[model samples]
Target: MNQASRDVIRPIRADEWPKAKELRLLALKDPVAPIAFLQTYEQAAAEPDSFWREQARESARGTRVRQFVAEGLEEIWSGTVAVLIEDAGSDDAFGGAVLQRQAHIVGVFVRPEYRGSGVIDELFEAAVGWAWSVEEVARVRLYVHEDNARAESFYRRYGFMRSGETVPMKGDPSKEEREMVLDNPQLVSDIS
Candidate 1:
């Protein structure tokens, strides 16, 4: 396959559970895993195959949830991002009330070699586009570890801004994750 075709970014298929599990495992092994993700490699690796399959199926297709992967040459996934819908009046994973319908981006990771090659840019573009297309989605949001400057910088570059809210990281009271958000660009354009 041609190089251009090798780097396509697209939604994963429901049956691609193995690929999803593989990419997630790889993400957990990254140097920033502890601060970058809430789950440990050991915990995820110990999950049964059925769990992975169910996760893949649920996120593969639906307006409420979506997972996108950047497939590199030879069809290996080089990066992935998942979006979970948070409805208004409901409690978020952090125990905070969800004030608006939003897409909560999670599990973002790109292979080390693909980090500076625009792979992440493409992934965010796709994820944010999907979020905005969904009905009543006011924004897209993600939380980054306070000490993860590199990730925070990229989120800012992608048009997200610190929301001035921080939640204590799970299992670690000393570390906090800061919320960042990107208001729907179409709304910005309309108001301009």
Candidate 2:
């Protein structure tokens, strides 16, 4: 679907490693980057070409993890999200989650201009749809910074509720991150 004449959704190809890396750098440059991303541009850019190549290959076919990107008419990626399959005992970037059959949503980003538009919804539809489509996944979840009210509100609109669970930050152990779980729509759909 085109929004204001912009074709906003597309999957990043395995051959598009360089583009992925570039977009990541742009995301890190944003003012909210410090909280939005776990890694800095300096760390990512410092990686050799091999790292980009491997990232592309993994996201291309890894059932455990997948990346989706939204592009504008200019073919510039405006947003992205990484979905990772986490079984009951899987450990993610945030550490271990004991929720036996769930997926962790991470690496979410949207360009300033694309905020408020359906661009985010489309990206989410793509990610959450993939999560539910997985036969082994029972639910999906994410962690947001307590200080990020905007993100918390967005998650609420998306059917994610605070799980009342908190995990300390991996980098800064003194800080805490809160968990939010996506309501399992299957329960409602199955009833009807």
Candidate 3:
């Protein structure tokens, strides 16, 4: 069977900070990291262990944010995605005003060896599914760098459409990131 088929997709536990930090550092070293992520490897690596521990702890709580990981046999982590709940009238991670209650997907990363193995699909499914479970979350969204075609294509295929919104890329105002959104399917069905 394929790795993806055998992998378990679930949220990271508070005690899994070490593993989370390792995976995040690895992601930062990826070739497309420059465009795929806002943080640099050097910056992330410089963070104290407390940072990762708190991050994992908060994500595990699943109250405001959650980080899901794809785990295979022997507890090997293959990928991760984080969802941040944004309340209406609150500022988002990018300092923009959130117009509605929503879930913003971020820090998406899958190991190179697991790409196209269906791991990404599972991760996204879990993230989006959890987002919809939140009360009053009207939609889900993410920002993709204009030059990250691969990520943009995958987001499009996963039912996210361009929202015609753009934001200056963090640390690089000369470049922009495009916003893509996916309305809550449950809400859509209800309206229909």
Candidate 4:
């Protein structure tokens, strides 16, 4: 059987904070973490247990955010992705002003061993599926660092198109991140 078939993709639970924290720390240690994530290993490692618990709790049940994980047969997490709903006229997680009702994909990570095993695709399927379920979401978007060619390529293959928007990488004005978007197919069909 394929790896995707052996694993289950589902939203995280509030009680799984420890696993979530572990996976997040591992992701931060990845070589691409510098460009893949906004936070550093030192910063995340310094946070207390309460912080991780709160993060897991919010992601588990918060109306504005949801985190999904790919769990293997042994209950091991293979990958994770999160979507945060952004309301029009409200501030986004990046401290930017939001111009539309959208879902911002973030915290994407897959265990190195699981790369190319279809786990990432399953994770995105779950994340984007949940994003589309939100009535207020008109589109789903994510930012890929300009230097992260692998991620950018994957996003393109997964049907995200560059929206011609670029934002300066936080704390590194020399680098930039490109915005990619996938409009809601249901909404698109309705318009057509």
- Give the Cα lDDT of each candidate: 0.90, 0.81, 0.96, 0.93
Count of backbone collisions within predicted model 2: 1
Tens-place lDDT per residue, model 2, 1-192, is 446237456567789999888878888898887766678878987999999888878888857788899887788787898888877776666556565778889889888887877778888888998888887676799998777788889999988999898877657667667899985688557767
Between candidates 2 and 3, the one scoring higher on TM-score is 3
Query: What tens-digit string does per-residue lDDT give for candidate 4 at 108-167?
Result: 999999999999899999899999999868999999999999999999999999999899
What candidate 2 gets wrong by more than 4 Å, as runs, is 1-5, 187-192
Candidate 3, residues 1-192: lDDT per residue as tens digits?
788999999999999999999999999999999998989999999999999999999999999999999999989999999999999999987888999999999999999999999999999999999999999999999999999999999999999999999999988899999999999988889999
lDDT of model 3, residue 94: 84
Which candidate achieves the best lDDT against the true structure? 3
Ranking by lDDT: 3, 4, 1, 2
Per-prediction count of colliding residue pairs?
0, 1, 0, 0
Worst lDDT 10-window in candidate 4: 91-100
TM-score of each: 0.94, 0.89, 0.97, 0.97
Clashing pairs in 4: none
lDDT-best of 2 and 3: 3
RMSD of each candidate?
A: 2.0, 2.2, 0.9, 0.9
